[model samples]
Target: MARLAYVIKFVADMDRAVAFYSETFGFPVRMRTPFWSEVDAGETTLALHPASDANPAGSCQLGFNLDDLRAFYEKGAVTFSVPPREQHGTLLARMIDCEGAEVSLSG
Candidate 1:
């Protein structure tokens, strides 16, 4: 069976975002630097990247099963919830980067 091992991400500030996810989610840092950081999510890898100042974020929701559900949205990620007819969930949010990379965070 084939498995999706990693999902590479792009962000504005590596240090800030890395610290935020690490402190908030408690996902250990697998590999990191100024350009990218790999988050160890046990079953999956959440790779973080820094986005530029000018760019529309892409369409891609990174669904994460987290312990601290509320804190995940506290990092200024936009909340998105369908009108009951779309999906069943109490929490949903999105974070867009300058390069048009979008991450939909759910609890």
Candidate 2:
């Protein structure tokens, strides 16, 4: 079977995007440049690309399997769409990413 490798999200500002993921999720920066950056998101790498006419922003919805959803919310780096709540027998929190993409944190 093929395995997942990475997910790329286009952002308007590379620095801000890098800061958001790095600080919010504590994903270490694997590589950084003005046009692109990559983070080590454990099993798969999360990449940030510069937004253009072809690659627009807010193009992906990512869900992170987290151990501490409430603690992440308390960081206040992301705009939580909803507080931690039960969904399908698991704790979940929805939020808008730095680039306005929807993301979920589940525990």
Candidate 3:
């Protein structure tokens, strides 16, 4: 059987990216270094790698399930690409992370 491991995101700024995910989504930092970092995202880990020419920021899209999408969005933590709205009978929203990656949130 195959199981998921890590979802890597190349970030322009390591500190900013770390702060964004940790503070906004409350994902605890598993490890941190100048070149790499990881956040414990439930079953899988979210890895933050320093961005370079070959691996640029905003190249990944991630989705998360929140208890209250509206309340989360209203907190003004990150800039929203799409505000919370009903789509196919589900609440969905999109927000841009510190590294410019598009992240989807649902409740």
Candidate 4:
């Protein structure tokens, strides 16, 4: 079986993107620089890359398996994009990130 490691996201500002993820989820930073950064999300890593003419913003949606979706959602500095719902025997909600990307959290 293949193991999942990282999910890279292209954003407009690397600093802002890194700050957002760090603050929103409180994920520890594994590595960080001006052009690139990565967050340690337990079993997987969330990577952030600088957006350029080739890499547009809001490129894709990133999903996270969390324990308390509602609490994390409410406490975080994020705008709710999709309200919480029950599906697949879990609670899920989608929120907009600093760079307009959709991040789904499920518990």
Best by lDDT: 3
Q: Which order, best to worst by lDDT?
A: 3, 2, 4, 1
lDDT of 2 by residue, 1-107 (tens): 12345677889999999999999999999999997799999998898988887558856546577767778778887798888899869887778877776665676
The global C-alpha lDDT for each of the candidates, from Candidate 1 onward, is: 0.58, 0.79, 0.82, 0.76
Candidate 3: the clashing residue pairs are: none
lDDT string for model 4 (36-87, tens) is 7899888878888877665588564466776667777777667987878997
TM-score of 2: 0.54
Output candidate 4 Cα RMSD.
Answer: 11.4
Q: For candidate 4, what is the TM-score?
A: 0.52
lDDT (10s digit) by residue, model 3, range 2-68: 2444567889999999999999999999999988899998997898988877568955546677877
Off by over 4 Å in 3: 61-107
Off by over 4 Å in 1: 52-107
Predicted candidate 1, C-alpha RMSD: 12.4
Q: Ten residues in a row with the worst lDDT in model 2?
A: 1-10
lDDT at 50, model 2: 88
Per residue, candidate 1 scores C-alpha lDDT tens digits across 2-107 of 2444565667777877887788999998878887688897787887766654422332235444454466545445443431122354554445546555544445
Worst 10 residues of 4 by lDDT: 1-10
